[model samples]
Target: MTMSSVEDSTQAPFVAPEIVTVGELLRRDLHIPDYQRPYKWTVRNVAQLIDDVDTFRTYGQYRLGTLILHRDARGNLNIVDGQQRFTTFCLIALYLAKHTSADVPDTSAAALPDVGLEISKANVQDNYTYVSESFGSRRGDLSHWAEFFLDSCEVVVLTVNHIDEAFQMFDSQNTRGRALYPTDLLKAFHIREMSLEHASPQLRLAMVRLWEEIPPESIHQLFSDYLYKIKRWANGQDVPQQGFSSEHVELFKGIKEADPSNEKNRWARPFLYAKNYTDDYTQENSTLIRYGALSGVEYPFQIDHPVLNGETFFLMVRHYYDLGLRCGLFQDDAGAIFDVLPELKPVLDLLDAHRRMPTHQLVRNLFDCLVLYYVDRFGEQSLDRAALMMARYAMAPRVQSKQVRRAMVNNYALGRSSARPPSTNLFQELRLATRPQEILRRVLASPELNGYPELHCLFTTEEGARR
Candidate 1:
């Protein structure tokens, strides 16, 4: 198909454009068409693209064709629509550039720091850009296949003006297969500029305190899902709405109190508890717990974010620590489990001997312990027993296969999970006592019991879990 101009009304004929590798674009010119939505790919996509390319020699569908870029003198290229693919290619290129280079300084070119990508200003592209723009970077793992693709794939670019025209051409020229979502496009816009810093450490750190506890491995899905939902909401689409109803203003309010200086008791206040209230940070405060729970799904950036206020996001941090506790890495003395199961006392002494062991070491230990506990308590059907196990754990089922738990745990212990906490109130004490029976009792006994709110309201009522 031909490249059209937003500036002109002419629908031109298709013309083959000059082919270029991502390296050339980095060295010279690239601009996203006004019509080109935004970069949306996450690290997962980046990793996957690399893997796909890596399989090219064997897997027939691996090699992606030349990407068309409409460049402008301002160094801005009207992506006209291959933005996601283009962005992904650039990230892969960066990965290849970094991993293959012997010089450590050159490796900085592939630097994919953990931060949000905001593509708003000129000269926005920078070192971190490639990583945030591509799914490969978001996914955080570059397989051998991806490495191969990063090392080899080249992009073909076409230049023109009229952002809409380019975008329309991009939309129509799809001979490949599936069409990407507009949400994906919007995401690409930011993804493309991943190298630039989007938020300050304050904001980023606040975000971390809010949702940092989410497993690093699942961050991509959480981010993608939230961003997609928000975009759909913005477009008046019928995307499923979870609960946050508050507009952006209210959400920010929650974060404002999240600061350490603000005194209003907040979900994040607990996090400061961790820092030992150092003189500089002790003044911080966050209202996440009070407002977050009250706001429900109407939460700002209601998506599964990494942090909120200054506290570790509830679900993620709680889950991670819970997992650790389950594995005997943490323990409770008086039946009260501290968040991380403090490494002190009798438990610490016992674990000290095995501290150097791998993640699988802990996971298997936990698994064996849990199984034995269950078997002793209620035999093999313990999972089905009336004992509210899910509530006790404050997490969902092991939906994410634990096959890699060993490796994942090792990464976590090594501080490599890029882990963070969950949003404020996401795992408040409410989650800790989530057993259906407990909920039923709470509902029947207390006005505020609400008993799991919507999802299990029926379970607490005459209706059961199915209801």
Candidate 2:
């Protein structure tokens, strides 16, 4: 459905909510939409649900949770939220019907639908196997438990006629229960934005698949460790002590191309032109550029650029993910540093060998962030010199102080420490520099070289060799 129809539905009156038992809820036809994320609930989640049913069976009617469904024009109930819980419940029902003599209806087991997506299918099989094994062990108690689960467990069913309202309600309701990561909310928001652009269903499904391919933890680290810090530091703001959260999602949500105001937004012209040119070039050159150098042509994306909403946001994420892998930012090994900046091998080796303390780790993170920002802005031009400059700047704070805290790193970056003069925000300098030599030429006050003997030798020796 198009977004206009969904947007208009917000003005319509709300439908009355209904409370239904698990059996009654399962009897109705349910559908899983393509835009929804894959089933991610593990065995622990399944066991918890089973345990909750057993613990609260004698406590009168127990509420399971809420389900927000969209009733389409064809009268199908498309699950907008609670797909994981709903699918798990279906597996439980099927297991009970097979293993117990409980008075469960035949239709409950018949409602189990086949999932098409590979990730969801694998999870479904794994969860079902766990359910079957759990049911087999509790053979004597299965009958009564099945009866209580089918009849006593209830859910608050809030069904809306429009897709947008369903998602809005989903977002509103999810705040209290198992908290969703900020990335999850971004996924949902962009899907809605894509619908507003009238993106084809095939295109939407492809984008979702591309997102699901990345491990969720890697994505979390990408934001928490690198992107979030660089964005805040470059803007001369202190990084949040509590880490990234839902409040900061707007940082990544930029102009929507479909908005009418974009036509008059002069600032958006360069981004839109680049996007259009890339699309046309790739399509036209798909056959001719099969091998060699031309095959790797990609949209020019910078870490500090304005994020285009919907599909481009997803592509930007993929670009950074590949970049992180190539740079070895996610792991302890700095061997990959040679690939881009071979000149930094001695410096990296010194840091890797001697910088093993927890405080040293903070300095390493600072070094990585600087190199990432440099490559993002200036490409490979003068990369070795730039990396050395960043290394010297990031490492000096650790050597100057006996005990380093997070605030010390922040102070060094912003030039607030007593050891350095004020007005030396390194990231801001990198952002404003027009050429590589500008960064290479900038200097910092040297900390006492005797504080760390090996690092001292490396720095002084490198300087001697350069001269």
Candidate 3:
């Protein structure tokens, strides 16, 4: 009877032991086992590995370590442990292979260089032997894994009776030294299994670029020191960091800390405002709508929103951007924001007046003014008296959340009756205005501006009276 290639069930048990490059390992579809935990390697960890290899010639010789793999029922080498280290090594290898000429064909074997040439040749050779013996008898198909491990790398494979042992081994290997963050572990899971290998680079690159812009030092410091502050705040205790949920706040902190300060680092903070830019391709669709809104220079779409996703962030950014543009709010770039500082001075002063007020309130008030200015300019009804009173009451201590308080100020500016409940009179007044700027000037010069305890005069009148 014709028999299969390996019909010798009773023949001497043979194992294929061999060395391989990372390429082959990857080609085999070799990956962490289902029972294996996610990749917990942080950006710092990755950065260090690359930095070590780049800076120290022999860095690869000593062998950072190895991983043990066993053939699963599917005949695949399921990583039992050392997945993080292995993955990191593979990443570095891929980067090096791309950056260097090691993978080029038609080159002499003598010219092909080892990744860890700085390591003693003897140590490198020993590393090769260690990897060779660990793969059992399947050496022929392991050229890729071998090249990476033996060339100043070391890995060992062993058969295990159960998956629990593998997990314990994994935990033990990764528990010490630099602590791996849970968020970082989550990142690995998202990157390896959750995301498609052939995913679009545009989205990923944009996320990475934006994340990189957040000052690394600031992220690290916030995680290290201020993250816990939110916990206390959430628990109703006084804490430094405010406005974030305790659990999420701490999680963000941990991730921020896990990110590397090293130059070789990859990955970045998840984009908090990624949706902002992605949602609108043009500056006109942005929050400010006008190019030269805040800076008065009409800088095209200079708005910077924390890269977040979905409609909430989209609308939020849109509203804020529009308000800032209309009100000419300047955050940075002194030359751009400098001119409007005077107009925003009262808003800033009112915000500073209350120590206990929430941040959203302050920002809201600022935006309300912008909306008022916009509505007055474009709306059929000029909200004269209401606009005047709105500006007047905005000077009050409690006028935070400029948006919520906007209607109030708009109603008051018309001056139908400051205390009157909601009525069509306010809307009608908004319609009848001839000059809205006149109302704006009156609001700016009203008793609220002059009498505001915190207000300070920048310029003097002809008679030297408070202007």
Tell me, by TM-score, which candidate is best.
2
Encode model 3's per-residue lDDT on 335-425: one tens digit a residue: 2432332434454454434423553343234234333343524442334333334433444323322333433433443333244232222
TM-score quality measure for candidate 1: 0.29
* TM-score pick, better of 2 and 3: 2
lDDT by residue (128-233, candidate 2, tens digit) is 8999888888898888888889899999898888767776787777655536777777777887778778788777777777777776766777777788888888
**Comparison by TM-score, 1 against 2, better one:** 2
**Position 135, candidate 2: lDDT:** 84
Best by lDDT: 2
Ranking by TM-score: 2, 1, 3
In Å, residue 158's CA in model 2 sits off its true spot by 2.3
- Candidate 1's error at 401, in angstroms? 38
RMSD (CA, Å), each prediction = 17.9, 3.6, 18.1
Worst 10 residues of 3 by lDDT: 106-115
How high is each candidate's TM-score? 0.29, 0.88, 0.27
